[model samples]
Target: MSVTVREVATPEPGRGEVRVRVHGSSVNKGDRLVMMGTPYVMRLALGLRAPKHFGLGQDVAGVVSAVGDGVTRWQVGEAVFGELTLGAAWAEEVVAQADQLARAPKNVPLAEAGSLPVAALTAWQAVVEEGRVEAGDRIVVNGGSGSVGSYVVQLAKARGAHVTAVVRAHHADRAQALGADAIVDAELEDFSATDARYDVCIDVAGSVPMSRGLRAVKQKGTYVVVGGPTDDPWLRPLLRPLGWMLRGAFSSRRVAVFVARPTPERFAELAAWVEAGRITPLFDSRCTLDELPQALAELESGRRRGKVLVEVHHRV
Candidate 1:
């Protein structure tokens, strides 16, 4: 995928909208997929031949510089962080609906908060909403070393669940450090074939087949698909996760595949947790806005852990 930076007219917020001076942003898997315009299915919404949006970043944290008419929830100079579905967060300034953003906690760094919106929201949706991870439950998070997986592990632990993080051997210690009760080296153990059934099984990597996830879950347990499906594009836009949903519909197990909905309520909840020291967003590397392409390249390399951040405007 080809990416470049350009100077564009600063967007004017419409009614009930707010314009923010983006201080920090992060690259995500959605950004990579949208930029690649791959699997041909995503093109229907992203672009047929090329990307519709010029801006690439989606996770944004910044100060509200201006507010449009009908906006009463936020005022100029309020710090906020949220996801922009239309994608242009890499720029110096971005416009978003007032309802789409939540006030960033004063205790959290704006740059760190920028990395929390998308990944944390996705984890919240999957682990809490879909998985329904409760205290004393045995939960396994595949790809527990990944961006979303890290959140899932932590959130589950926060809820008092016994979390077993499945990751490469190299990330085992980090997973444990993130609050996982047990660390399973995926390279050394076949999680799918293991006889250890769980109360909930969260597939963050999408590396395993539906049957394996089903097998990993107990008879009445939940199996949640967090990330977009992996494999050929001809299957669907988000891919094989749809098939998992279909399979779960007929099974006795509570299987669910859902896309994360990033709203102010969820963002506020996460912000509160961050302020309380319950959830901490991790970053692999920090870069300037001009180095976004390089940051994304590093993301594609699969060597980095957690989120990669871009510091657009340094806080004074």
Candidate 2:
């Protein structure tokens, strides 16, 4: 898969949609998957040979430049941020359905706000909704240094859960700053081999065996798969979770896999968290519209920490 920036006709908003002058957009796992057209299993919905959509950013923050008919919640020039289920967010401007966006966090810059959307929502749902993490619960967040992992750590801490952040050794201090009660070096320690039993195990790294993750959970505990396997993707990324679910069905453990559902209301909830200072997005680097290809290449390298933000159009 290759990326090339091409100038296309600037799109106009349709019914219930708004045209946004994108000030900041961020690269994410979904962008990489869409660009590669991998896990061919998803092609049924994405595309067969190539992506069904041309553009490739999912999280966007910008100003509403135009609003279509029947739209009342937003006005032209309102700053907003949200996720686009369809790719097309990588451009200078993008058209987003009015229902899928919320006002950008007033407490932070639009570049930081652009880093939320998918990762924040995914972490919230996994930690609060599916995992049922609560006060005094012992929770282990596997892969605690990434975009989603960092959020999981903070959200879990806000809920008063005792969090153990499992990550690479060098990121130990970073995870601790995110409120980890304990840090486990995945490079040197096998989390499953530890004596620590957690009430909830969030496997975002997806590097370890599913059985190992399941074993990390305490008896009658929950195991949530928020990311995919690290194996080369043809179908492994899609199939590993299914296999885990099937295994879970026959056991007493409560295991579930989910994809984050984006909505305006969800973004509003995240915005509130931001305003309260409970959530802070982490950034690994910054890029511009013309550097999208290079940014994506860095993302593909798996060396990035936190989110890689793309500056699309600077709003005054």
Candidate 3:
């Protein structure tokens, strides 16, 4: 549960890999789960006693400083952004497969692009891939003001779906600005208990019960679970989603437990969306590399409205 900034050897790119001089990275839910080593079942892949990998970040944006053998997709100075599933993005340099990165969006600062990879990809997958959202579809996004939820609201809206954003009282305006057609303040309203139904129910907050989320979806509609309680020391986060998936078999509605799988093509699509002004990355705060622990603490406190960016090589 403790994090420290320490010096490590500069990593070198191997075959078909590229080393990026990282300018920015951001704290993500995965980072927190790994750092805490919770939901004990994850330990099997991480480590039984402690995590095998200590690096704590997934999203990265920077210039490709070096490319290894057989890598021709990038040059020595091309600006790129991507995700590293196992977490190594907190450092000044990171080595990743050439296929893992995509050209950074020209409309945004390269550092700011770091905030887009994981969260944006998750939203894209939820709204487009999983939910199959389309024009005239009524979609409700739980946690509309969150990092992923913010993008979901916009993406769904851009797809011509009517977006209902379920958010905290303080995040109402932000959700509205994100193109949410309706704002259901969680403090004053329980969207699950409402008579209104949606063609797609995207639960990014995981604050509501799974059955209720499923109930909110119309018959034959889709219920996509993007996140859940991560603080549990045992199986809460994992088990909760599994339970939803199991319950789906008996119900008329479709249920999906979403796990983001990022691809270079998807990254390109997100970049295009940003450049076209269809979606924008939201930021709650910024912090230096050395201050990442504090930034992550703020993220875990559930007080942040959007992405918490960490400036690695700030000069970018």
Candidate 4:
């Protein structure tokens, strides 16, 4: 059931689970896809008529208020962050598997912490997990102004690599502010036509053609697709990943799709990076809780610079 600011039953921590009083939930590209049901395949599991979990939010950062009987490593009132299994985040309370919860970085605000789980994890899986992008590797993050794309830019830079940000002309300046060594305005410059090459090319924009993305990378370079329309019969949510894997096998050039699940270890890594100031999660705009409906509309319109955060409580 979905509700807000009412006496909804507070979720209780089940065995191996914990309940969190959420402070903020950040909207992301996946959340946008799940909300729209565009590819005609997402509803097979997420529910056809209306989603199982009525709440829409996903990336959560808040304080643990209760714990399940078997969970001992965590205590009540500790700041924490993670992804929920379904769509229970927009609501005031959420119950998560205990093993997935992670302590928030000591120096980061809960609101900013909420932005990292999904977006950053996808970037991590792409650069670190699939691409094996090491120090000095050249990475190009297409659509660098969006949530995941923003993190990819910062994280790639943090890895001691050369980073180029590709975004629409309007966001070019903002991308540079986030430490992009250079910016490519997709509107003016056809990044596909450029002869320059990168070791790893991450595409979050989805509008860019797969062939064009592949061309921007050098021989044996990695091309990662995070979201978009896909051609798949099963696991619609994973179509992009599956397609990349299949095509990559036949081609000499590397192509991979990135899908990441939130885990305590990965969340911890995100929190640490943010707290240490090595990675800065560019917040496009901080919206109030009541502004969620409007924010979703704007987000779906496809013009945002960074993470669109719904901050429930100001940093205290």
TM-score of each: 0.95, 0.95, 0.95, 0.89
Better of 1 and 4 by TM-score: 1
The TM-score of predicted model 3 comes to 0.95
**Tens digits of lDDT, candidate 2, 1-316:** 6799888988899999999998887877777777877677778888886677677889989999999999999999899999998868888889999999999999988877888888889999999899999999999999988889989999999889999999998889989999899999998999988788899999888886866677788889999999986446687887888988897897778997888898888889999999999989777788888887876776677565457888875435
Which 10 consecutive positions of candidate 1 have the poorest summed lDDT? 230-239
Q: Which regions of candidate 4 are displaced past 4 Å?
A: 1-7, 229-242, 301-306, 314-316
Clashes of 2: 0
lDDT minimum window of 10 residues, candidate 3: 297-306
RMSD of each: 1.8, 1.8, 1.7, 3.3
**Candidate 4 per-residue lDDT over residues 1-316, each given as its tens digit:** 2224433677788999888888878887667667766455667777788766566778888888899989997899899888886756775778888788788877767777788778888878877777777899988887888777777888888888898888988788878877899898888887767899889888777666655667788998888877664333356545555766787887767887656877888878877887889886557788877777777766656564357887875333
Candidates in order have lDDT scores of: 0.85, 0.86, 0.89, 0.76
- Estimate, for each residue in 30-49, the C-alpha lDDT of model 1 and write its tens digit: 87777777667768888786
* Poorest stretch of ten by lDDT in candidate 2: 297-306
Error of 3 at 235 (Å): 0.6
